[model samples]
Target chain A: MKLLNKILFGSLSAIFLLSGYDGFSQAPDKGSLSVAINYFNDNNKIPYVLVRVKTKVNGKFKTVPGIPLKLFLNKDSAGLLIGKVVTNESGEATSFIPPSLKKEWSATIKHSFHASFMGNTKYDSTSADLTVGKAKILIDTVGRSVVATVLELKDTSWTPVKGVDVMLAVKRLGADLNINETATFATDSTGKASGDFKRDTIPGDLKGNITLVAKVVDNDQFGNLSIEKTVHWGSKFVSKANDFNERTLFATRAKAPVWLLFIALGIIIAVWTVLILLVQNILRIKKLGQEA
Target chain B: MKNSKSIASDEQIIQDLLPRKFKTSGRIWVSLLIAICLVGIYAYYRQLRYGLAVTNMRDYVSWGIYISNFVFFVAISLVGSLITAVFRLAGVKWGAPLTRIAEMIAVAAIIFASIIIIVDMGSPERFYNLFIYGRIQSPIIWDVIVITTYFFISILLLYYPLLPDIKILLRFKEKSGPGLHKFYSFLGSFWTGSHKQYLLSKKAIYALCVAIIPVAFTIHTVTSWLFATTYRPGWDSTNFGAYFIAGAFLVGAGSVVVAMYIFRTWYHLEKYITPDHFDKMGRVLVLLCLLYLYFNVNEFLTPFFKMKESEAGYLNDMFSGSFAPVFWFAIFTGILLPIIILLFKQGRKPLPMFIVGIMVVVGAWFKRYLIVTPTLLHPFMPMHDVPEMYHHYFPSWEEWAITSGSLAGAMLIITLLCRIFPIVPIQETINEHHETAK
Candidate 1:
């Protein structure tokens, strides 16, 4: 009996110690961020950045928000200053970056946060050594699109096809040399097509020599169609363009929620449990009476 | 007149009626049952080795013949409650000789019912998960809870009535060996046939009878809900609970009839298990079959008329589609034919009733099969992008071995139970004889 008691005690303590180890192991790391972002694609790309700056509030002293931040493409000073904007309520600012920088490059965000007493606040310059990859462009010709507004295809729906290669070829009427201007483009979610033509890199005189033709070669395996369209040189000509906007915006509507079914199932289970208990108690009482 | 004149004294009767060692045929039967059981064990080992892939089950057809067999076992076990409790409560004297037999069937069937369910589990190794991670929300959990309760109650009901008989067996030391004699003594040595002990045992039996009725209902009802709670078309019906219960009673009563015939023939129990018993059991089977047929109509005909988009595939599968033959066979053999045959007075005799009983039992097995398989084949989403084999299901050799093994195991338990104790309670039979003679 004494040996049995000791064995029981030892096993019970082992179980408790094992459970405690599991509990401690499950604690989340405090330093890392668990972040997920959803964004609407104008053309096919959405760019956001994670910016962290140190401060003199209590811990590691460095920079803060709302300071002038500049992004340079390469070692050359010829790179454009993208934008200057203040951080919002979440101490983060998000904006659309031009598609011209589709290749690898590094960036830096410089900012400062003030101390409570307005003393010498630390200036923190945080640099993110980054590489920007090309974003996938999707086009859906079956679902609703901007062309529906113009064409009034009310009966038809347009669906966007994703991951197809599209090429836009252009030519000019006045040039003695046939300027074969070509830019690869893809479609967005609503099948609206867009691509970067790199107009800023070309001289102003040769810019007018551009006529655009978009051709989608292949559709993805899910039956999404690929489309190609041509843009003429004389259509909405805007000269002296500094940055090329290759983004297409599509409209989106909210879907019905999926949680109501689960709620109904939960209620049914609760009612069933209660009914079982009630029946058991009633049966128990009757049994006791019969024995008496 | 001559047989009546040769009536033996109580001691002579007890000596003649004590549980004896197995004869040559009995030894052969036991050996065969044990052999089948061993084969089934090996089959189960293979199943454990290969996972559920050893069976023909796929994602689309998650459940298979094992589940149907489970339902059949649970259904047949209800005979114990019907014969022992319901008949006893109603003061039906003819049911006295059959009570122990029905209770034995119940014990054996319920034991296998539990075993077959574990065989059906995908991770039988993690069966303790049902206790540890058991969610009250799942119908499977409810089934486990009620089945265990029903099992214990049925065991006590069988045990209480057998106490007097155990004391009688203890008196015959040569027939019941030293080991079994000691066992009987240990179990009922204190049962001295005292008035207080009799009162307590009687009260306990009565209480279990009352308690078992609801638990019996809950066991089958929860089993029905395992299907009804799911969104499958043929299975998702309000009438499923009643349908399952009615079918269960029919099968259970049918099993009792069959067992009564077997025990009567083999043990020369013609005087005990009378023709009147078979006639009465026949009448009970007819009523249960009719009730089951009514539930089947409500369960099937309503949906068939509506032919709702969700139910259309499942209904068609059973009606005139792939499963038409099995469906029609179950209806005809399980309910219609048995009801027609048992309706006549001559048909209610021992021989004809025995035939009808076999028909009901076999048909009920297929009926459970139809209930489980066809609905699973018609899940909401179309089966796609999986292996071609996933679209169809047929039980593998391992499954067949295990299923047959469970059946043999049940029979073996019943055989052993009869060997240890009188299949029909000798004391109760003698008491009833005294009452009738007086």
Candidate 2:
């Protein structure tokens, strides 16, 4: 009886331990973090961001490589100059900061590879503090060549301003600027204008800033200005166009392997059919023996 | 010169084999069975009026006593194959007198097995859905097909052998009432008792005996698969089919032993159902019990060995927890105790064997309950978000009424069968007697 008790106790403990181990192993891990993001864009504003990490690595503050380095802004903030772009090889990024006097301002650099390593820096820089002349404007267009399409400027009310003439211009770095050449267009019935301004026909050199001026004929409504906005263009802007083309090509190349998958499924079915026949034959013989 | 003594002619055998009208006690038994059946029918009416809600079964115990009772009936029905087909195929001459009794029990139990399963269904009204929407992969469909085949084969097996007896009953129209006499004649009027008819009947019986073996196996195997196919810890095992079949044969043979004892005692059938018959049946029951015990150990031990995460809770429940007492009782009474008791020669006497048979039948009923309900209670998800009543099950009055009705109904069939036909095969008994005399 004592020996039997010892054996029973030994078996019981072993079973408990094994069962506990299995339960622990199958429990789902819950430590990993997951995130979701939403982006907004409009006619005046595009959802673009550049994220760079300035971190202390190997005892030196260095910028991280291969960060997606993009920026995003809410759709309501489209009228404000928002979003940013990364620097090309020189470790500098360009951004169009909207001239808002509000101090609820922050900048985030989002990285694709190190998606978890998101960083944000808040600044109290207001439009009054940062003088208009000292703030440099950078324009990064995603198209290979600039097309001077209609730039229909509307207020928050969305009403078109008649007889509001607008001057549009472009400049590129390391090129001659033709300041004498400009496209003058007016808003249509639906607040839209379209015309082409050639890169060579631009004033000064192609390397500098392109300034657009909307000179209002009458200041009937709000005390806003016939504002002049200058945009600096560079070579870094051209890669975004190439990125779009590459994605399209990659999607078209993925259909051939899908057909091979169906052929493999047919082969599997054939093998299963043969196995079923063999098992049925064996069962039939056993059944006959039982009857006999 | 060699045939100096006169032998009992075939007419004497036929006259002895003819079914007789019921006596006072037989009439009383039939009336009692009918009364119980009426009460059961009223109970079923209440259940139909109120839905299954009239039962104590809740969502957690969705299947209560009805399913276990169904399993019990199916298990008991398996004896038909054991006595009629298995014994005949093995040329066991001693089993000849018991064959019709066993076959009658099989037919009665299988008939109620079908009825009780329908009673357990939530929508007996939509029973046609079982055929229309039947999934071939489901064990229920397999059970339906095999059980139907087994029932018909069992009926044919019962009928073909009775042709000679039925002709004898038809000739003695004075012993039977006008109504019953007409019924008997209608059933067997085609049987001329010619040599060709006898030969044909014998061939058909042989064919049915052959056909019923697999159908019998398939019925119980598919019934086992109903539980085995599920992924529950207690149920998910390849051994279930054999384990179930073993237990089924045990309980079925045990019931037969009890029936043999009762019929022999009540009808003064000692001349036909002898003590030797009881002794042989006791041995058969003991063998079946031991086989079932071995399978039970295999079914339980390996799981107790590993006790994987999924099986641990279910094993704990059965082993030393809430379900422990019932589990051990079933093990001891259904297999171990019967085996131990039937091992002794004196214990194999009719009275003690009858007691053991009752124990086995009751224990096997609880064993089937353990098979179905406990595993359902221990599904992968924790039992939550249901009413408190759903967590446990006890048969409501309506459920008891219906279940009791089914049992009484089974007894009623056997009682009616015995009233119409000789409970013991007179011709087979006389054949044995003549052989002994020679």
Candidate 3:
């Protein structure tokens, strides 16, 4: 009994001390965040990087949005600032390589990107870094066959990147469709891979323009790289003319189907005319009753 | 005077037919109805405060009890047109006394029908947008037009006949309170019942009788179109318009029978609304039930026979699936048993007719529920990958209260109309008495 009293007294004292800062309440301790950064170079030709901030919530990892991230080039503390961004719904923030860093960009055969999320009351601070060698992919249509070439920068000179895997695909709305049966091909000693222009009957824009892409997935050196080219191999899509003044079922009130409007209007006019006549008769009844 | 050999019989008819203040039971009935209406009003308050989220409606079952209640009210209101316009135009003399009753029911039911439709809308404030930006091609707008026309016509129909009755009511200022006296006078002070006035009033009545028939069919048919235009399994049928009309006529006739029995007993109007009225209305109810049954067979049997892939799930659900019990209950009680019972002359008696009438009404309400929700549940695209709660639906307490309130409010309108005006046409009774003496 004496030992139990001591233990209870000690627990109560701990609670009182813990909550005594603000009259039985204390500020909550923030959870630490995990940060991951990925590099992307699209048809934009300008390289960009995205950062994702996440934290453990209810014993499950949940992406934390609205965290401000600073993406910098090369050095961690005194690097050139590429851009500032805030995380979106998926806890992702993307910032493009700024034009102000063009001189610094051309000076390097390889580059380093650093992303930092400053500490907030709801989350502790976190940072992530990625280093990638400069690389580019080339895609061209050559006599019914498609060819892609991979090249990397080595000491200020373009060198063939051999044995790198390339994916040939047709860009679509949600995801790209593979161009050939064996879509992925490895570059030979010459840094070039070729596939037959096989996919057809793909629907495209009014001018029959479909986008073709040759891409390399995440590589230890190049990160992610892709190039897109527009081709006229897809089926043509002729858009219907949308005239605002057209009269149809779904058109505006004045543009309603003529026959329907006539039928409806005829009925309304006929019915309301008869109704008005009846109401007039009621007024005549009142007049006659007054005279009586 | 005026073709009557005796004045005492006329006075007695007037005394029996004049609106009487409610007795204790009547007051209690009205109070109970008022309580229900108040509860419904409070439910509506909650619905408005918290939004439609308070109801059990979700994406799967967007149209819930409110819509079904609206359909039921619209169906029941069709009775007024049948009893007042169709029968009156057919020159059915026995129908004259019941015209006022049916018209009252019609007016009451339609008022609530419009109100319930507004209650179904998420943004009742934007109701004007429907008018301003309404597409004529839309069946919903067609419904609004027809129903509004029907409302005005019903009001006129109820008013045109009540002029002479109002004049009679004006004679008894002592019986009707000062408030009611001024109200009736305001309604019919100029109604001296001259021949020229009668001629014009008759012309207007005849025109309305003709006008209301087509308008009535169009009203319910357009309502049916609201569902038929949709591509749902049960609703995507060509037979919906006629099927709806048949059911509407059945429920309307059933309600009239119920109202007739109550009025006959409560007012002690045995001499006026006799057993013959019940017997004839019973026969009418049986015919309507049979017609509706025929449509029901046509609606269900073909789909059941072919068992098209799209319709198979809904048909099975109606036949012996999760909804089988409610399905069979609506069928047997609403259509089949009413036919079997009303087939017998004993079932045409006032009390038996009233019981069957209640059955038909209650069963019809559930049948409307089945029509709306079950087809929605068994959508062409099944409700998978959704919360289990979305897979099923039952009315929340708020839905029940608001629906009950709308119904009770409708009845309260009828009750107040009965309290203020004569249920049976006093002039018709006077004319009948004079003819009998002659």
Instruction: Give the clashing residue pairs of candidate 3, or none.
Output: none
Tens-digit lDDT string for candidate 3 (B133-177): 899999999999999999999999999999989999999999998
Model 2 interface CAPRI class: incorrect
The stretch of ten residues in a row with the least summed lDDT in candidate 3 chain A is A18-27
Question: Which of the two, 1 or 3, has more lDDT?
Answer: 3
| Model 3, TM vs. native | 0.79
* TM-scores of the candidates in the order shown: 0.63, 0.61, 0.79
Which regions in candidate 3 have their CA more than 4 angstroms from the true location? A1-136, A139-147, A151-212, A216-225, A228-237, A241-245, A252-254, B1-9, B306-317, B382-387, B432-438
Which candidate's DockQ is highest? Answer: 3
Candidate 1 residue runs with Cα over 4 Å from true position? A1-292, B1-9, B12-16
For all candidates, what are the clash counts?
18, 24, 0
Which scores higher on lDDT, 1 or 2?
1
Candidate 1 structure quality by residue, lDDT tens digits, A1-292 = 9999999999999998898676456554223121211122223334434333334544554344554344434332334423344444454444344466444322332111111111123333343333322223332222212121001112243334444445543433563211224334444455455444433333323333333333332222211122222332323446665323421111111111224335434544553454455345334533543454
Q: After superposition, how far is residue A121 of candidate 3 from its true place, in Å?
A: 20
Residues A232-285 of candidate 2: C-alpha lDDT, one tens digit per residue:
532222223444333231232333234433543453354335334433433443
TM-score for chain B considered on its own, for each of the candidates? 0.96, 0.94, 0.97
Q: What is the interface RMSD of each candidate, in Å?
A: 13.3, 17.0, 1.2
